[model samples]
Target: MLDGLNLEVPQGQIISLLGPSGCGKSTLLRVVAGLTPAKHGTVSIHGEDVSQARSRLAFVFQEAALLPWRTVWQNVRLPFEIRNQKSRKTIESALKHCLEIVGFQPNDWHKKPSQLSGGMKMRASIARALITDPEILLLDEPFAALDDMLRSRLNDLLLRIVAESQRTMLFVTHNIGEAVYLSQSIAIMSRGRIAELVEVPFTYPRSSELRSAPEFAAFYGRVSEALYRSER
Candidate 1:
């Protein structure tokens, strides 16, 4: 249902898709991820179409979407099992690195999804996405279900991941504060297209204190006004 919508995410930067519910923010992410087909226009990464560049990308959903029956280790390793691309040694090395990156302990690795808390489940999900060592990450409201504190922690985790790995990221969110906090630019969507693109002037490696700053509030207000106009 997108019409004339276009966006370009610069390399190694985060761009957030922000809009009201049902405004096609998630749909746009799906199209970029190749989960949903685009009837017109193209999704490309570094001049290659999405189909060609897919191997370099990874996606994280709102829900952990982990199999209830699988333990955290099993779930995180599922991509390797499906792709069968890496050797056992490489896979194990990757699993260890990804788990460490997401701050998971050895004891929690054997637990099933049912046994973990909400934040822990998200950590597993993020670790699963990282197993592939993707260059681009597509996130669809990944922290929406968590409490404020958990959400903030995960947001910081995401920032750290990007800083360390230099991966380009596209994040979809209904939360304006999140968009301002995480993105270098925010694309505000409405009626199936980008209504406005707002730049976040704040520098990266931003702390939680940035959210309480006067400049942050001013940028937030600007984005809010743009969103209101888009909805009208």
Candidate 2:
């Protein structure tokens, strides 16, 4: 059972859940997405309980999760299509905006999932998540498959998207450095529970300079210590 997960996720901020592999970070995201049963806690999004917050949340899984049979545009359009809704010009505009923000060119939208590289596929996955205009986005190691350079690029892309959309996000990552880079706050999980929640307290557009900042080193130390203690 998940124990004592109480914490505040400020609206329009990005909070990452970080832990080692085999920890329950992804499981937490799944539960928050309502894909699995949340045993005892209430999830609130925008002051509304999420269990009752239907049609208000979006989930982006790792592995792109795109359908091979569908082209990229069709795949991104699934949220509208699944609800028996027609795509509006406004909706297409939103999709195009999201794709452009994630660095997809015009020709990229027509390609199938199989035609895209790992990074492109993940970008398409992100586009699909944002297309619905979700207030809260749950991302599960969405860039883990890409190389370090690509992952850093996507990290910047993700931060830009978050800024543009002003969407709150719960990101799950096994990478410590990435947690510091992308998150304003971090919940370090262990054994189905959050061991510590630390605020980053850094300003937005967190530059590469922060990597050498004293605050950065201090926060990293605290997170490392928390994880080490959680293991015992």
Estimated TM-score per prediction?
Answer: 0.98, 0.92
Model 2 lDDT per residue over 1-232, tens place: 5666776788898999999887788988887888888878777776777778857788888889999999998998888888766758877887888788778899989999989999999989998888778888889998888898889888888888887778898999988878988999999898878988888878897766777788888878888888888878
Candidate 1 to truth, TM = 0.98
Q: Which stretches of candidate 2 lie over 4 Å from their true place?
A: 212-218
Tell me the RMSD of model 2 versus the true structure.
Answer: 1.8
Give the distance in Å from residue 175's predicted Cα in candidate 2 to where it truly belongs. Answer: 0.4
lDDT of 1 by residue, 1-232 (tens): 7899989899999999999999999999999999999999999999999999998999999999999999999999999999986688999889989998999999899999999999999999999999999999999999999998999899999999999999999999999999999999999999899999998999988999998999999999999999999999
Model 1 spans with C-alpha error above 4 angstroms = none
